[model samples]
Target: MERPTRIGVQLAPQHAPMQATIDAARRLEDMGVDAVFGWDHFFPLSGDPEGVHFESTTQLAAWAVATERVQIGPLVFCNSYRNPDLLADVARTIDHISGGRFVFGIGSGWFERDYIDYGYDFGTVGTRLDALAEALPRIRARWDQLNPPPLGRMPILIGGKGERKTLPLVARHGDIWHSFVGPDELSQKLDVLRGHCEAIGRDVAEIEISNGASVRDGIGGVGFERLDALHAAGTRLLTIPLSGDDGPDGYALDRVPAFLEWRDRKNG
Candidate 1:
């Protein structure tokens, strides 16, 4: 059976105050978004480079208990930031806090500023991906060894667009694969992912395909027009970001209700 199309909101954890972000999260859940996400980065990706920002896992714990019914996670946690075993434990704890409503989104480290400011090695792409590959097995091992285990199977969402390292990792471990690629690229990537899955005797369909969507008012450039082709190419999930920078009032969620309604229309 095909998975129902789902809508998620990525609250970028930038520009706004922490309280505002949390409040926005609760509001989004009430407004019927299926999932809520935060990006893992030390500083703001937009607005003032030194603008207000919060750590992903520390805040994800708070978000877990703040909103009922919405799956909560980082859009993609950087693998280089923490020890794999500790990361697994943290994810498990948040999973327990949410009563099993957690989706673990992770990816190889990127953003040179994050690494430099935080004093981690800013390695080459190959090295970072290799670290991620080594870390995945350790995370799985740590999860198995946790006292309570995770409250559920704990879906892992892997984000990256590379066909070489990223797609193969998605084939082996990811429950969801997220990327910014539109329909055309996604179709080609699916072929690569299928080849990887075939090598392992796994079914490519077992991994949920995901992409970003633009707001109705053109707040984001993720291209809502391509949504149909994206879905036709096998994307089952879409996420839109809400930023305070969208306007002066706050995180501009005024447009999100319509987007959620669109999700309903698609599901129907």
Candidate 2:
């Protein structure tokens, strides 16, 4: 079955007060966004490196309590940061808190600075991917073993563009696949992902495709032309990242209504 077109706002929890981050999530939910996301990192990914930042999972828990609707999760949690079993328990707790509105988005660890500063081993990409591969099944197993399981079958979102290791993992486990590439690149990656699905005897179409909107351009400037291409390329979930510089009012979400109109038109 085809998934409905959905829009998500990633309120990046960097260079902003914790209250602002929480407020932005509420506002995004009010604006009718399907999901709200925060990044998994100790420090800012852009701008001043040592800027104000909130931890992703904790912020997600806060968002669960603060918002009545809108799914919440990290854009992609670093698998290396926590034990898989513990992460599963944390995810389950949040799922219950949200009444089943949580998406578990995870990835192989990147950003060497996060690992180094947080005292984790800054391993090679291969090693990190290996760790992620090991973690997914363990997380699933732990979820089953929990006293109270998640409210529903929790959706797993895997973010990356690796054709070899990552796509295969997505084929086996991912309910949603997120990538930061344009239409042509996404189409190419989709083809590669399909091959991986074929290898595993899984249906590629079962995974929803999610793409990131350019933060530099803002959602309005991305234009319907680009959105059309992305929709054609199999992207049903479009996510825009709001930076801390969007001002103290929180997340300059004026463009969201237009995006919603576009999504409605496309989905229709």
Best by TM-score: 1
What TM-score would you give candidate 2 relative to the actual structure?
0.96
lDDT of 2 by residue, 56-113 (tens): 8889999999998899998999999999999999999999999999999999978999
**Cα lDDT of model 1 by residue, 95-203, tens digit:** 9999999999999988999999999998999999999999999999999999999997999999998988999999999999999997888899999999999999999
Point to the candidate with the largest lDDT: 1
What's every prediction's RMSD, in angstroms? 1.8, 1.5
lDDT of each: 0.90, 0.89
Q: For model 2, state the Cα shift of residue 152 in Å.
A: 0.9
- lDDT for model 1, please: 0.90
Candidate 1 regions off by >4 Å? Answer: 216-223
The residue pairs found clashing in candidate 1 are none
